[model samples]
Target: MQIYKNLLLKNQTQSFIDDKKHEKIVVSNIQSRKNPEDKEDFSKLALANYLDEDTGFNPLGITAYKMNYFLPFAYSFGSLGNDNRKMEMKFQLSIKKRLFENLFGLNEKYYIGYTQTSWWQNYKHSSPFRETNYQPEFFVDFPLENHSFFNNLRLGILHESNGKGDENLESRSWNRIYASTAIFYERFLFVPRIWYRIPEKRKDDDNPDIRHYLGNFDLNLGYLGKDYFANIMLRNNLNLRRNKGAIQVDIGYDIFNNGIYWYLQYFNGYGESLIDYNRKLQRLSTGFLISY
Candidate 1:
């Protein structure tokens, strides 16, 4: 009887140890899924955590959503307008905040993002801002696993406007819901997105024909290098009869290997700005960029 009791106690102890081991394994797997083994992914996680530590914002940390840059000299190929000068300054500010992580146990995260781009005619009298575009969006990001080239998928709703008021003739605004994906191959990354504009009443609609220039789809291809990087953005209306499109290229070199980069950008096409969505533009700009 004594021997039997001792054996039963030992078996119970062994069973508890085995259960703990299994629990640890499960936790490790989940953590691995949350943090991927890519350079960009790791940097993003690090930036978020660092921001949280500095601002004491808990889990909500703000990070860069798009490229942040300031160009002092952007020269246009031809005349812009009577009031506008051929050479002007341009800048962009973009940011994002994470709202939730893994809400549905699917390794998905939610974020809110805002981006603003401005074209400033500093050389002109009074140095007025020619045009400014504002974009705000809410998105959910899903990390993919074991895919040959696909790395991430995102679904989002976006609103963009020039903020000139709905009643004003200079008003330009639109709302869209979009789907996009991130594909990675070697040192290159490709992001393609398709969007459907939300319909509005004819009376309330601003820039009704904006889609003919801005298009329903766009592609961003980038090359990530150790000391340099380059990106290309392409957009088209996809109309066979009256096709219209735009292309932008950006090249940057790491300055001092810090987060600052010397940047050069060239844009050729329509829809570069909301106020001039229908006008074609060709510009070359050089400036500095801040990256994480």
Candidate 2:
């Protein structure tokens, strides 16, 4: 939720105009006399279509997944007070798709998404993987036009686990139901989200009091700069007596006018990863991202 708001297709939906009509609109200020059909034609056939159109085997409703990749090289100075573990590497790959549109005769869209993040101890002898977090979620997005600031709302059910069972007693996992809405103001975007964790059986509960560290709600703020993007994520439990939370920052700049960009990130929190869910961590990293 760190403002990964599809930058590659930022202007993908721009209205199109014929050569003659375009000249008149630009010169005569007759913008209201544009062709609606031509606009739709250009929108659907634009370069962004190649990246988002449903082209693969769609045995079911319209389904298309877009790749979101982030690969980073990191170094942690305060490694939770551990030695020989300061230098590390990390990567995250995410994919999401629209499964169906206009569900149950309602103008709502259903989507499925998955994200995987791996933490590697690349400086070690074996270069072992410290931990990997896997998250899969299903959500419904509803478009809104009533308010000028609010544009979209979403509700989702999420499952996140480290995939480590009895092997690691400290393995982390959780199930949540969340609601989110996006507010847009010019080039600024803000999203606020709240979630409720589902109770699990005592025997299977890995981190029962995770809400204290991971928090129950999150807020994201984003800004689209001239040639770069910046986002900040904030989380808090909203407990007056025992306040706890996390913060993450990300900045990315397009490189070579391409889809790929140079990315930089910093995180200071209690739940940075599945394995380190209960430990405090401060890390900084730089990498490349291919996002849309």
Candidate 3:
């Protein structure tokens, strides 16, 4: 049913005007919790909220909206890291549309987007640079694009600018790279992933080693099934070296009518990040989401 044909066949000849028509909105939370082993009664915490929208009939044919907020409290668990509390807030909006569409391949689609931001950072005595930071990012989403056995198998990129050292935060920009390629195996998602920390090309080199090591594995089970869901992630960081990883599991049941989803989660693993990977303690984190 995907037989529109590749634009390449046209040999750069066509009576084409950009086709624009669409709308969308999204809300999501990115959470960073203290590693339980961090044992320091006070652990680092960061919460990021994001909102984005897209529309048509305009230059580039798109409009965007986004915002982020963070709070890092000072606390201690005896020998854990000392509290020197810090927090930051950020907001941004961007717009873009296709400069060109279906210019190269069969059933190919591409678009351009631009984003900007405003923010504030406060801490003990507060940061001296009390001004809005500026950053920009580009993005692309492709479905069924593996190029090989995985070709057209689903691939995409979400990236942003970079943040400052521990002294600063990400406001107008944040640079994160994430990609996913998945296939339904017996109705379950089988995906392999890899992620790395970008050397904030702009940070002071006081601690060059600040760049964390890369390489980790993430696994998901029973993705399309209603009765079970599980996830596992592993990473290596300065906090702990070798064999320190995090794992999470969830099990839920769907109520037939009323269109409500209810579920209980079982979170037992070394805490996330290197600092929380204690073999002795496993915390239980549970929550639910309702959709109408």
Candidate 4:
């Protein structure tokens, strides 16, 4: 079993007088996970969460699914202090694929996904609550010049279920479209991204979560910086009717490899889901990695 980790420590200094605000305290996480959430596999925690001398896997990341798969599972975790903690688990799987193969209107992408997030008392929520989401989606991807420019383009629709309650929850689905283009020279590359989500409101009087729509764009750059090794990313986003969104994006530099090697990263602004509204945008994290 391979493992990875990303750990970061924030300066204790507070940006404002409100000590309760998220300033100070270390931010650590696993950007991607290779393993699922199974009690028999708590070992995944060492690599998925933080540095745990006992666990053998990398401190970050979990095993992810393959390309043609409809849904994807993403893993991440963090804590402001020993007492304040948060954890999340997500499962996304593809349903209908290669439908009609070449049929234009009949061919479509379909998927199902669910997510659960929990919080523990420390500084944030006094009582922890779980938000659940049920989603069905359709998408298409186009391949551009493989080694040159515009290697791929994609678009899709996402149906979201009510997150507040289990039963009273209503199914809230929406249509979303996204496009990606990349230019590559040797190992260095740059990719551009654009996406829009058209959320529909529910007429049901029982509707508790208000639905909304949004548009966002992002650009990323990658450099082979060196042969057999490359690193670079630039991403930005804009949400309608909300403050400017922000985030930190970068991977590790595994140049120096020794016994017990590790990986690390720092990110804020923009949560996991490109559509997450309440996710924070400031934090630092670092941890060891395995197998690079």
Worst 10 residues of 4 by lDDT: 64-73
Please tell me which predicted candidate would have the highest TM-score against the true structure. Answer: 1
* lDDT of residue 223 for candidate 1: 82
Residue pair clashes in candidate 1: none
For model 3, residues 82-146, the per-residue Cα lDDT tens digits are 33222333233454444443455544445455554433334446543333333344434354544
Q: Which candidate would rank higher by TM-score, 2 or 4?
A: 2
How many residue pairs clash per model? Answer: 0, 1, 18, 39
What lDDT, from 0 to 1, does candidate 1 have?
A: 0.84
Estimate, for each residue in 1-292, the C-alpha lDDT of model 1 and write its tens digit. Answer: 9999999999999999999999999999767644534223323423233232235443546777788999999999977876689999999999888887888898888889999999999998799888899999999888777787886788999999988865547889999999998776777778899999999999888878989898999999988775578899999999999999999999988665555789999999998888888999999999998876
Q: By lDDT, highest first, what's the ranking?
A: 1, 2, 4, 3
Candidate 2, position 202, lDDT? 90
- CA displacement after TM-score superposition, residue 159 of candidate 2 (Å): 0.2
lDDT of 4 by residue, 201-239 (tens): 556433322222122666666553321222344444433
The global C-alpha lDDT for each of the candidates, from Candidate 1 onward, is: 0.84, 0.72, 0.35, 0.37
Instruction: List clashing residue pairs in candidate 2.
Output: 6-292
TM-score for each model: 0.79, 0.76, 0.41, 0.44
* TM-score: model 2 vs. ground truth: 0.76
Off by over 4 Å in 1: 1-60, 166-168
